[model samples]
Target: MSSQLLMIEDDTRLAEMVGEYLGQSGLHVTHRADGKSGLAQLQGPEAGPLPDLVILDLMLPDMDGLEVCRRIRSLQGPAAQVPVLMLTAKGDPMDRIIGLELGADDYLPKPFEPRELLARIRAILRRRTDGGTPAATPALRFGSLEIDRDARTVTVGGQVADLTSYQFDLLVTLAERAGRVLTRDQIMEAVRGRELDAFDRSIDVHMGRIRAAIEADAKNPRRILTVRGVGYVFAKQQD
Candidate 1:
């Protein structure tokens, strides 16, 4: 079946153009112009073939896109796995960070090229679908941190810490890949399921938060170490 895409944008003309372009690209595009109505469509008993992706505009007539994103993420079952790409005119780095923090897989600035948008959409879907072949099964155990891919959760000293969906995924991504210095762009692609922007330091900020939760000393940050100008490396075992 062709991948399904849901778009929630208040602008009719932009929505029509994007729908047409994406439809021609082999995706089945579903469009909604209002936030409340769009959310209803998403939550309705028959949500159709279940959209593989969601393109959400930040500004909506009824509710902010961030709230819409938060609600969608709170849904149970398969609905939670649907990847979201935030579309916004707010170009501030903080805006992007907040979206990421709110569980959006990625963010695209306004006035973006359709081709560039398509590329990002495809990249995110690819990351979410592919790249699960682990080279080894040797579990890394450090202090209270235990990464269990089979269960898809981290246990800190045998206790499950409440983690946001993105945080859990990021931790697993780093631990599984282990010892490899993953660039910020690479981490965003694999862990957050999005394309990186030129001025986005949201990854660093999120990493700091994750470290605080999992590390004995967040200030020192022994588990996930920054590699200066390169990126970050997840030490399987602390030195």
Candidate 2:
């Protein structure tokens, strides 16, 4: 069966084009032109079962795309866990960072090739699926911290840590290579399966967030140590 995708976009032409392309790729898409309708589709029972993923445009006629992203995240259970890929016309990296911090799984700058969009969508979905598997390694334990590759969850002191999907993947990558120093480029490539955009600080931002959630003292992180001039290492801890 095809995966259901909800696209909240205002451009009719672009929506049709993207819908047709994604449909050809075996995804069933439902398009909403504005934020209000998008929210209704997500909240109203007629929206059918929750979509497998959401492609949200940052600009809408009635509301900010970021606000919509927040609402989607606020939904209960599986609905709140839906993967979201943001589409933005703003070239500022801050917007993308804010969107990611607000629960967007990924972001694509507007005026992009359809193929790239498809690749991003596939990447996010792939991560949501078997991305955590195939590691050939068992769950990692670090004292009070637990990184469950099979379950794709992280817990600190037996309490579930609220991490974005990307953050979870980042933690897994670092843990899988405990004690090895991985540069920012290496970490990004390993977790995202892509290179960082030179100046992209999203990786650091994510690392800080992860530390805050898992570390005993985020201000002085011990598990993920910064090497200053080098990279970072996942301190081999004792349970």
Top-lDDT structure, candidate number: 2
The TM-score measured for candidate 2 stands at 0.91
Model 2 spans with C-alpha error above 4 angstroms: 131-137
Q: What is the C-alpha lDDT of each candidate?
A: 0.78, 0.86
Give the poorly placed runs of model 1, Cα more than 4 Å off: 131-173, 185-198, 208-222, 228-230
Error of 2 at 119 (Å): 0.6
Worst 10 residues of 2 by lDDT: 130-139
For candidate 1, the lDDT comes to: 0.78
lDDT of 1 by residue, 1-239 (tens): 57889999999999999989988889877889877777766777536567888999998998999899888878776676577899977556677787777778778889899997898788767655544776555555776787765455577788765455556677877887789999988987786465677677877777876887788788998889999998899987754
- The true-versus-predicted C-alpha distance at residue 219 of model 2, in Å, is 2.2
lDDT of 2: 0.86
